[model samples]
Target: MDFEDACDIAEDLQFDLSGEELIDAYRERADAMVPGEPGRAVFLGYLGEFLAMAGRPEETRCLRGGGA
Candidate 1:
C-alpha cells in the first residue's frame, strides 16, 4: 500500500492500539513497502518521529530490537 493509505490506517487504528503496538504496526507496514519507492524513507521516518513524539519508547525499542 501507499504511504497515504498507510497513514490513514494508522490514524484510524491509533485509538485501538497500545502505543507500543501502534508503533510496531506502523514499522511493519513501512518495512513491507518496496525499497526505492518515492516517499518510502519519508514515510518510515515520519512514523518513527511520530512514535517518539507519542512517548512510545517501548514501541521504538521494539522496532530497534528488530533491527529495522
Candidate 2:
C-alpha cells in the first residue's frame, strides 16, 4: 500500500495499541509475519505505527522507502 494508507491504518491502531508495551506486542506480531506474503502491507503498517508510537516517525517514513 501507499504511505498515506499505511499512516491511516497506523492511526487506527492507536486506539487498540495505546501504550509502548502494547505497541511492542503489535510489533512482535508484525515481525512474525512471513515475508513476500499478502500480510506484508499489514506488517509494514504496524511497523510504521510502532515507530510513530515510539517517537520515530522519520524512521517509519524512511522504512516506507518513499512517498511519505
Global Cα RMSD, each model: 4.6, 6.4
Per-residue lDDT over 1-68 for candidate 2, one digit per residue giving the tens place of the 0 to 100 score? 44465456556666666667656655665566565545556656677766787798787887667646
Question: Per-residue lDDT for 1 in model 2?
Answer: 46
Model 2 spans with C-alpha error above 4 angstroms:
1-17, 65-68
Could you say which candidate leads in lDDT? 1
Q: Model 2 — which ten-residue stretch has the worst lDDT?
A: 1-10
Checking candidate 2 for backbone clashes, the offending pairs are: none
User: Per-candidate TM vs. native?
Assistant: 0.54, 0.48
RMSD (CA, Å), candidate 1 to true, equals: 4.6
On the 0 to 100 scale, the lDDT of residue 60 in model 1 is 54
Candidate 1 Cα misplacement greater than 4 A, ranges: 38-43, 54-68
